[model samples]
Every structure is written in C-alpha cells, then in structure tokens.
Target: MTLHQQIKAASLAALQALYPEQAFELDQIAVNQTKPEFTGHYTVVLFPFVKTLRCKPNELGEKLGDYLLAHTSLFSAHQTVSGFLNLSIKDQVFTDLLLHNFNNPNFGKAAPKSKKVMLEYSSPNTNKPLHFGHLRNIFLGYATANILKNDGQEVIKANLVNDRGIHICKSMIAWQDYGNGATPSSTGIKGDHLVGDYYVRFNNEYKKQIAALVSQGMDATQAEKEAPIMQATQAMLRDWEKGDENVRQLWKMMNDWVYEGFNNTYARLGVDFDKYYFESNTYLLGKQLVESGLANGILYQKEDHSVWVDLSDEGLDQKLLLRGDGTSVYMTQDLGTAKLKYDDYGIDQSIYVIADEQNYHMQVLQIILKKLGEPCWKGIYHLSYGMVELPSGRMKSREGTVVDADDMMDEMIVLAKEQTEAAGKTEGFSDAELQDLYEMIGMGALKFYLLRVEPKKKMIFDPKESIDLHGFTATFIQYAHARICSILRRENLPIMPDSSHFQGFVASEKLTDAEGKLLLSLEQFPEVLKAAANEYSPAIVCNYAFGLAQLFNSFYDNHPIAKAATDEKKNLRLMLIVMTAQVLRQGMNLLGIRLPEKM
Candidate 1:
C-alpha cells in the first residue's frame, strides 16, 4: 500500500471506533497533507462526522485525534484544532516511502482482483477523414482504457468501422459517375479527403437534381428525400450479397482506400484496435436476435411487419428492432454486436466509450440486454463523455469547418518547433535532435490539453492557451523536467551518497524551505495514481503532474541543489530531484504524455 492509503486507512479505523453509527466511507474522509506554514504533515476534516455522531465538533476531533496517534506509529506529532485533526509524519518514514515509490516495480499499477472489461470507441464513418470531433472521441476512449487498465481490470480496446451505409454509397456513386479513371495520385489529394470532396460534391449535385424536380411541380420535401439514394444503395448491397462480380469489385476497391486512410490517421493519434466489427458483418445478426426475441415473446410484431419492444412501463418509448421491410437499423446492429462480443470474450464487463448524446441509446440497450437474459448485462457501462467545442462553436463537418486530426497534429508540431526556436533553446541541438524535441513537446501539449479537463465537461480547445508555457499545459511540465535535467548535468555528481559510507542522512534546520515542501509533494505520487484509478479520471493524474511541476519550480527558485554548502544536504536534494523526475515520468505516462530531457 502507498503511504497515503496506509495513512487514510489508519485514520479511518480510528474514526469508525469513535463514531460507530456514522457511515465511515473513505470518500467522506478528506485527509490533506498540511501546507508549508502548518506544523502538521496531514490534516483530516472532522466536520463531516459531527452531525452524524451528534457530538460537540471539537470534542469529536479531540477523541479521533487521540486515537490516531495512539494506534498509528506513522505519525510523529498530533493535535486537534477547530474541529480538525492535524497530524505530522516523521521525516524518515516520509523519505522511505519516497525511495520505495521509485524503486517499486508496481508503483502505479493496481492489484488485479476481479473482472475483465471491453471498451469500444472511434467508430468513424468511412466517407471522411477524422477531425477535431473525432479527436475528442479518440482521446476519451484511449484515456478511459488506460484508467481501467490501471484499475486492475483486463481492458480490450475495440472499434467498429462504419464501412457500410448510404453515406459511403454516395461517395462511391459520385466517384464512379464523375471520375474518368481519376485516382488520388492523379488528383494530388489524400484518399479520405478526396473521397470526402466527392461526397460533398454529390450532395451539391443531388440537391440541384432535387431542386429541378421541385421546379417541375413535385413536393420539395418528398422529392429531396433519400429514398432514391437508399433504393440504389440497397440494390447495390443486394447485388454485392448475391456475389455480383461488378459490385463486389467496386466495394472492395473503395473500402480499401478508406481503410488505408483511417489506418494512417489512427497511427498518428497513437490509437489501435484489438478487434474491428464492420457493419457489413453485424447488421444481419440483429434480425436473428429479433426473431429469437419474437419466439420468446420478448417483443411484439405489428401488422405492418415492424418488430418493437414496448418499454413504456420503463418510462421509455417503444424501440423498433427490425423495420417493416425486415431491414435492421443501427440499434439492431448494436444488439448483435453486444451478443457477439460476449460470445467471443465472455468478459466480466463491457464498456462503451461513447458520447453523452447517445446516453439514452445505451440505457435502452442495457434494458433490452437484461430482458433478453444476458448474464453480462449487469456489467455493461456507458462511459458517456461530453462534446469538444471550439471558442467559436461546435465542429460541423458539413459546413467545411472541421479541423482534421492529422492536420491539427502537424500544426501543433510546427508550433512546438516555433516555440523552441523563438526561445533560442534549440541552439545546441542538431536537426534530428530538434525534430525529436518537437514531437515530444507536440504530443505532450496534445495529451495534457485533453487529459487535464474532466471528460464529462465540455472543453474549449484554445490553441494559444493549450500550448502556453506559463500555465497548466504539458509544455509547462516538460519544461520542468528539462530544467531538472539541466541542473543534474551541471552538477555532475552522484545524488545518492553511498549509504554504506554513512550512519544516516539527516535534514537540518537549513533545509526547511520549499525543498522540504517539494519532497512531501513527491511522496504523494503513488497516492495520486490510486485516486485517479478509483475515480476513473485521467484529469486527476494530469492535475497531479501540474502540481508536482509547480512545487519543483518553487523549490528550484529557493533552494540551491547544485551549490549547497554541505555535500550530504546537496546529495539528499539531488536525490529528491531524481525522485521527482521518476514521478513526473510515471504520472505523464499514465496520461499518454512524454517528458523530453531537453526542451
């Protein structure tokens, strides 16, 4: 256990004994390490228990405080003041935990006790390239998977490519109609972007065609409906299903281009899939499940041939499983996918890293799965996240306002190089060295900007502010790491004074400034990881990295690590820096950021 966990656990035991009737959930107990000005090492708020125990606040604090010191040998000093218990830990124990934190192999890993989980995200359509909106989806999906894995759950990251749909057919049809054998190489356009251009072109031309029909005295709305496109697409699908050589050849060629384009984008963003489910494969399975549901009386078939489940008793509308023509809808494919996943993995939990907009869909899905007698229904989780918006507005691809993910990444790398050059920090580095620095800074800025915000809260991606060096950005943290590395290089000495040569290392009154405070902050790294896992928030870990960097900066401003008067004191402080670097590296790794040694 981490020192923080041990401390919290010890305190909880004492509080439970004092207030037996009070519900002593650890979440209700706030144990904060005391500030530099305070005398204690940690403080606990007793106010939460005051009303529960029906006792005097100060008296309750006193009793709990007394019990803590008497029962736990970790704390060196203890006191009660104003309904709060303040306890100070011995320096030896504090330093020991710090040393152990860096040396322990599983410092940030969680204990594996139970359950395996499957997560699905980034199910993008094939007609277009990934954009800023998809970035939010990708980051949230990846971060959630990392958090779950850190929480000791077996996590499988999966994706479902929307490879089959009318949208894709629109692009294919447009390409076939307009192209006189013009290829991506001939047009000098990226494949996905090229296809997307044709998709937009198709829409513009289709609109004009519909307008001509309306001008000829047709109902405008009815004339503009997708019935024509749907009919053509369905005919193509049926042909492809029936092994028509022409349709099969065209579908394979177009899908290959889209998949290649998507793979390039996914590689740039550092995302991969263990398995992929195509709509082509799972779309038909829903019909089978619907048939089974009908046989078992879980659903009712209407006179019009529509199959639905009446969920009005559950305060939800009746959801259609199969359409009148026996065609499966989006929800049907999802049901089939769920069953397929369970049959494939038999996982203890299934998590869908989907947008909050689909919150209702998941709720209905879980209800249907439970009613269908799926054993794994109880473990289904919808990791619903909010939208990513710019300062102007939400990204809309149809408006030609979406920021492509690859383009944005390239922009960030350029900005990072500009920042380093403008700061004159690239003087001593070669071109290759400078390029490496650029990638680290760029990725750090990207990951930190995304992970620092709460996933469920809408975030504004301010370009200037996101890469700012003065605030809570990844660049800021990377700069701190570089600064420390610089100091260590200048000193050129072993930070660890061979303990075999000394009786013990001691911290005198002279080392009682920000150095002490920084060391204490470093001790909280393991605890930060534990809290991040428990809360299922990468924001917590992101915040900890910023706080650690801030503390290190404060310590560097006041304490002279490279020029301390005594060798022992300087070595101890250098050890603190080494420990700090390790903690920073581990914390940033959890958030998918890297720390460059030189900025």
Candidate 2:
C-alpha cells in the first residue's frame, strides 16, 4: 500500500476504536499531503471526525494523533491546528524508500492485470496525409495505452485506417481524370502526399463543375448534385464497393502509396499499433448485424430500401445504417469493427480515441449497439478529445492547407537545433550524435507539449513556446535528467551506485528540510502513476514529471551534492537526485517522450 493509504487505514481503525457506537467507513478518513507551511508529510482532517462524533475538533485531533503514534511506526510526530492534524513520516522510512527504489527500474508500474482492454486511435483516412489534428489524436491514444499498460492492464493498441470510402474515392477519381497518369515514384512526392494533392485537385475541380452548372441556372444544391466530378467520385465508390476488378486494382495501388508514407511518419512520431483494421476490409462488416437487427424489429427499412434504427426513445434521431444502394454507412462499418475486435481479444473494455465533433455520433453508436443486442456494446467507450488548432487558425484538409505532420516535425527539429545552440551547451558531440540529440529533443518537445494538455480541451499549438527548454515543455524535463547525469559524471561518482553503500548510514543524522521535501516528492511517484492511469490522462503524468524536476532544481541550488560538508550528506543527496532521474525517465516514457542522458 502507498504511504497515504497506510496512514488512512490506521486512522480509520482509530476512529472505529474511539467511537464504538457510531458506524464508520474508510471514506470518513480524509488524508492529504500537508501544506508546505505545515510541519508534517501528511495531514488528516479532524473536521469529519468531530462533526460525526459531536466532539471538539482539537480534542479529536489529539486523541487520534496519539492513537496513530502508538499503533504504527510510520509517523515520527504530529501537530494539530484548527481541524487539521499534520503527521511527519519517520526519517528511516524516507531512507528506506530511497534505497529500495533508487535503482529498481519500473518501480511505479503496477502488477499485471487479468482483464484486457483495446484502445483505438489514429483512424487516418487514406485520401489525406496526417496533419496537426492527427498528432493530437495519435499522441493521446498512444500515451493512454502506455498508461494503461503501466497500470497492469493487458492493453491492445489498434488502428482503423479509413482506406475505402467516398473520401478515398475523391483522391482516386482526381488522379484518374486530371493526372496524365502520375505515380509517387514517377513524381518525387511521398505517397500520401501525392494522393492528398489529388484530393485537393478533386475538390477544386468539383467546385468549378458546380459553378458551371449554377451558371446554367441550376440551383446551387442541385448543381452540387449534378457536378460531373461528384458523379464520377460517387461512381468510383460504388464500383469499388461492388468489387470491380479495375477499380479495386486502382484503389489498392493508391492506398499502398499512402500506407508507405504513413509508416514513415508513424516511425518519426514513435507511435505503433498491434493491429490495423482497414475500412476496405471492414466496411461491409456491419451489414450482417443490421440484418439481424431487422429480423428482431430493432430496425426498419425505408421505401427506398435503406436500413435505419430509430433511437428517438433514447433522445436521438433515427440513424441510417445502410443506403438505398445497399452500401453500409460509417456506423455499420464501426459496428462490425467493434465486434471483430471483441471476437479477437475478448477485451473487458474498448476505448475509441476520436475527435469531440463526433460526440453525438459516438452516443448513437453505443445506444444502437445495445439496442441491436451486441454483447460488446457494454464495453464500448469513446475517449473523445477536442480538435487541435494553430495559433493563427484552424486547418482545412480539402484546401491542402493543414499543417502536415511531417512538416511540423521537421520544423520542430530545426527549432530544436537553434534553441540547443543558443543555450551554448553544445560542448561535446559528433555530427551523428548531434543529429540524434536534436531528434530526441525535438520529438520530446513535441510530445511533451501536446500530452501536457487535458485531452478533452482544445489547444492552440505555439511552436515557439513548445520548443523553449526552460519551462513546462519536454525539453525542460529532459535537461533536468541530463543535469543529474552530468553531476555524477563530473564528480567521478558511481552513476548507478550500489544500494548496499547506504546501508550503514544513520537515519538520525537529520535531513535538511530541502532533502526531506525532495524525498517526499519522490515518494508520490507511485501514486501519481496510479492516479494518471485511473483518470486515463497523460496530463497527470506530464505535470508530475515537471513538478519533480522543479523540486529537484530547487533542492540542488540549496544543497551541495558532489561536495557537501559531510560525506554522509553528499551520498544522500546523490541518491536522491538519481532516484529523481529514474522516475522522470519512467514517467516521461509513459507519455511517449524520451529523456536523454545528455542534452
């Protein structure tokens, strides 16, 4: 159990013994970290006990404090103020905490869980290259998976590529009509980039076609329907869905180009998937489920033969499942994918990491699945996150104006190089080493800044502020880890010292307040990790890493680590920072950010 948990249990037992007639539960025992001005490591609120027992708060505090001191060896002393009773941890406990976990890697990770979970993210469309918005989805999804894994859940990370749809057909039709037959290899453009260019071309040409019809006195909406490009795109989708050999062949070719490009980008982003579900393979998936729903009166068919489910009872509109032409909609495909995932893994939970604009869509998805009697419906979870925007404004994929993921990464590296050089910390390095360091710093900056924000809230990406090394950015934490390594190296001390070296040390030597504070901060690591996992938010871990670094830096300024007044104090200080670095590395890794030994 964690330190807070231990104290809480003891405090609860005290309350039960003191008030035999009054019923009590653990919830009545409220424990929190003592305020900085307080003289203890933890505090128990006496107000709850006083209010329940109808006794004076001060009286309850003293009685409970004395009872706890007599019952456990955890606390050294207790002080009471108003309804708050602060308790200090024994000095030997701090030393034991440091010695046991200082070098034990993966110290904060939980025991393996039996229940499995599947987290879906990065559902990118084959028609376009990944953009800034995709980065947020990918990072949030990837980090959340790692957090769950750290918490001991058997996490299955999956990706559903929208490889076949009207959107994919748009790029295909444009390439067929406008291109004098160009390929990614022939034209020196990345595959997804090449396909995305045609997606834009399809939009531009379709708009002109709509305008021409309007000039001939057709209604704008009618013109949009009559546009030849739109007609051809629709035909392409239908043909591909019907398994037309030529159309399917073309679709496969273009999507292959996009997939190759996507692989390169994913590698640079340091995100991966255990399984990839393609729309081409899963688009026809939910049709069988729709048939079953119709047989059971859960759904109805329109006069035009389109299938739909009425969810008005659940306060939602009737949602279309299949069109008149018998082609399945996005919802149908999603239903099939959800089922396929469950059949494959039998996961206890399924999380979909998607944009918040589709909140209503996800709500309908879950409701309809339950109504349709899918067993996995109960496990469906939508981890909806808001969209990402630029400092200037939002991006439009159709206009080819989005900040491409590759471009953003390149810009971050260039900025990293400039920032690192400006800091004048480029003393020792080879060309290859410098390149690797820049990638680490650059990617770290990108992931840290993005993951730092709560996923549900929208954020504006500020390139300059994100790359700056001195603040809450990933670069700041990376430098802190490197700083500790530098200290050990410069002093010629064993960077990874043997735990036995500190065994004979005297815990009664009296730690400076700064040393105690640092130890206290380190002690919270396990709980911080657990809290982050429970909340399914990387922001929790991100802030903890930054705070630890902040605390260590403050302690560093006050204490002499390599050259303390006494060898005993110096050894303690060295071990504290080393433990601090171990935690920062493990925590940041959960957020998909790497901390370097040198920066």
Candidate 2 lDDT over residue span 420-498, tens digit each: 8998867798888888889988988888877888889998776445455569988888888999999988877565767
Q: Which candidate should be chosen as best, given TM-score against the real structure?
A: 2
C-alpha lDDT (0 to 100) for residue 490 of candidate 1: 78
Cα lDDT listed for each candidate: 0.77, 0.88
Q: How does candidate 1 score on lDDT?
A: 0.77
Clashes of 1: 0
Give the alpha carbon lDDT tens digit for every residue of 181-270 in model 1.
666778877778878777776777777778777888889787776446535666766776677888768777877777878888787777
User: TM-score of every model?
Assistant: 0.91, 0.97
Q: Give me candidate 1's TM-score against the actual structure.
A: 0.91
- Location of the lowest summed lDDT over 10 successive residues in candidate 1: 493-502
By lDDT, the best candidate is 2
